[model samples]
Target: MQASQASSRLGQSRTSIGTPAAPRAERFRLTGPSVRLDPRIYAVRKDIADIALADRVFAPHYAEAEQARVAVPSVALREGPSDDARAVSQLLFGEGFAVIDSEGGWAWGYGLHDHYVGYLPAAVLGDMGAEPDHVVRAASALVFADADIKSPVVATLPMGSRFAATAEGAFLRAENGFIHSRHAGAIAAAEQDVVAVAERLLGQPYRWGGRGGDGVDCSGLVQTAFALCGLAVPRDTDQQAEAIGEEIADGAALRRGDLIFFPGHVGLMADGETLVHANAHWMAVVREPLADVIARLQPEHEKPVLSRRRVLP
Candidate 1:
């Protein structure tokens, strides 16, 4: 009999092989802020698996993972483990990440502050140390090897970078070097007027993935301002719209510190009637009457305001 005919006959006889063939392998979906995977029942990538049992691999839960601190001035979090990969976000100095796994010269992990996951160059990370006592508040601040401002600059810290410090007469001593005290603020301190932080970046050119003083995006402005105030927020508009704070039911209720979200943009409420944002429209950070912004963008976006989230309250 042909193989197909023989299989048909075997199917008719219920009882058969030494043991019933095992059920088809099952796959479970695993997701995080920056990755998604369908891991099979018996096999899981080391980067996504938490532990390996005798016959199966377990997904990473991040419950007791090791932590590392970003030691460089800034590092790019890329989508893949390569230098040419697209950068999804940037980590300022002193930001922390939960080390999930390491491969080649990259570390796959999640940001401790925003829970953003991606790969960071391994050389930029360091063992966790004392918590930061002060944060660099200037758009960019220069660190000197000595307290003297004339000394050769050591490192240029981006706004929102934090470090352990002790105040000298006019400078703050950090592990790397001495930074002018005026450029630093107590870590526990928060800017009550978040809008004021946004105002300082008035002419900064807009960049799609920028998060520093020289250039920034809409969500970057909001994120950097909040960071100066010791509040942790995510990097993108969608995440910010959903996760930052409570929603305001009325548009008139919007106030300073309230984050206004549009289709794919975000801005901070400067006052009862003003909105401030790093906009590509203006190609720079600008403040405008809330009503004007609403009227102009509403027609284009099909709606003026998507939602208003009160991040402070």
Candidate 2:
């Protein structure tokens, strides 16, 4: 399902940002017109192909993915390699990207964190330097030219941004600038509650495909919350509902951390009766009674709660 219309909950949050691994394409090749692939996550075009899919797909050229990191605070991965193209998702600072091809100032590849494939401006990426040792845990963090807060703000990063840094007195020295140590947490530092991460992002503007503090959508909000805790989740709602957590049998009682699904939509349960979600209807992240959301959504859209999946013990 399209992320713009669907709802999904966050994934499990772990303490450490794990290593960025390349996507392992299937070993067997499928020959013929019936070979089906999801274009959203597979970097295959009529002329170019991700090396991982070389054996499974036909292309005149196949290239191995080069490791790259986002140098800018955030950049949009678009439908095409142009400013006018639709942004499928936003890549946060320090997120890993596997570049399978590049031309005319655009890089074609997929995100290492979620494997979403798209075109991004080539200028926003840099050589992957040191492995990330920390993640931005605050809703947003400012990068200062100097250790002091009064220094010029060079950049701003959304939550879930990762980086490698050294402690410089009371501040952390990142490649871009110094950030207050309090704004970041060690990659291994796990937040115990997933709901707390979602609550921290309340009031963010709802943007389609936005996954961080600058802007966020339904699934983006959930994905960002989990990423901060060091977990990678699919970028869209249908994928999230199909892959994340176990299905709760029908008529089962609801609990915190349950993924509440509607027609092309998903939300996280704050409690049995409360839900937190980023919705276009409200134009922002909102927390309210589950009953109120259901009442409003059902009449307006003719969609009811479809399923509830439990993601926490």
Candidate 3:
């Protein structure tokens, strides 16, 4: 009749089960030989049944943050809206939870918590604490793997810069290994996520080493924030440009979040014709007319206009 009643009835006539008691035991643990229950109380009763069988149940007031310390390891963190971004990152998948689960291509998670629910793959979760709402300054390279603070070119981070998440092998053991890194982290990222997440930081700030929303740079701005949100965009605009979608030669057809790029620089297309970026040349993060930004920085024919990223499900 009702959902609970149906469950109770189904639990009783589990002919497929090896024993009559097995169905009840599988669904719940509260009811005993002498007990029967109203259908409305089936779920509550079942919970008690499971607990009675277990060695222990959770403390009534256990903190979510504490509980999160042991949540099902984050098996995946992919890009796109909460619908179709199911593609997985091979290296970083199944790494374990770093911080809270926020939003995804298909679903949104708690600020920094996970449940017993199995929703997506291992690519969705970033390394522990790699993605934090609040940020701290980087004294050294924040070395994660084989790296030291002396080589800023390797990690590409300046001293006293703030960052979001650091992986163990991604940033330190760089494939190119030419871009000298002062800090070495094992942050294994998808490389394409930097541009995707960095687009969110447009109009923020162009701090030399600042990575959070407070301030960011051409490369640091893109690389760090994406890691915080469980995406991994590249460190530079050129390499990142390749990762995004086709070129938007004209700003008229550009979408809201489309990214615009210039020689050695990048910005985002905001509203009708606004470009958002932390302009080092201008010394502040602000919005400009799309036409003007393109005319000033980009070439007439090859003006890097639209670099759309498909990050939603």
Candidate 4:
């Protein structure tokens, strides 16, 4: 949609995320004066019904002027084809993301984390990459705009370089003998059609409420991952478990993307056999055999097993 047209729609429309619902067809008219988003400049999953649901769907500038950094050494990656919301960019750090874009259930934002600067699904952000300075582990890889891992020559990534963030696909789902864990902090990559994205972040840093490339949490990790894959995830473990539509019996045929929860914490499994997440004990992201981790965490609660809901894209 043209900016002028979008503005006109914003002026005429009244909407919100938590408002009462209308028939989905009455939402927006792309052919009308209502501002439709630019497919080239920004895009959400086509399955999304409306763009007017957001206050601001896309913009050339950051909605608010702010400087933020990745607080954690590693955070969730989102799903975006553009530089704005591609896997992991540094732009989300303390950047003021506008609610201009939409992808069905998700919204988009812009930030310094994404040097390319554009709209992305809003759901990928962990509290909008809220930050100051980001945390970086000793051996960290900071991906920049002009990055080329396939290239033979590239500058060495310094330990502390701020890049832009694009999107967070899905929560990391982990498994143990009969338990599931989704370590959002352990996620490394997204947008790839993998069975388990959480296992990819095995050995990432551990940061609390830290959703940057620096550090992240169990819930943050899960929410971040699903955002990239165009999945909407909640920020807390309990809330996340409820989003799973499919539930596996304790010992059912275990697979990837299954969530594992503990009494006070949660994590994700990369595969039926291995789990991934950051830990205060491990001090970083790691993958443990599902059966072993379950045995360790199971003894804590009378039945520490809370609820397992399957939330996948």
Residues 170-230 of candidate 2 have per-residue lDDT tens digits of 8999878898998898888878677889988889898888988478888888888876666
Better of 1 and 2 by lDDT: 2
RMSD of each: 11.3, 9.9, 16.4, 14.9
* Candidate 4 segments exceeding 4 Å error: 1-91, 94-196
The deviation in Å at residue 125 for candidate 3 is: 23
For candidate 4, write residues 1-313 as lDDT tens digits: 3322232232222243233433431232222243465342243223331243223343221122222333233333344534445443333323344443444644443343222233444444444342322211223342322322343322222222223332233211111000001222212333443224444455668765444355656765665556555465555566566654467676675566767776666767676677676566676767778677667767775765665545553
The CA lDDT of each predicted structure is 0.73, 0.81, 0.38, 0.43
What is the RMSD of candidate 4? Answer: 14.9
What TM-score goes with each of the models? Answer: 0.77, 0.87, 0.34, 0.44
- Worst ten-residue run, lDDT, model 2? 7-16
lDDT of 2: 0.81
Clashes of 3: 53
* Model 2 residue 12 lDDT score: 19
Off by over 4 Å in 2: 1-34, 300-303
Q: Best candidate, lDDT-wise?
A: 2
Clashes of 1: 0
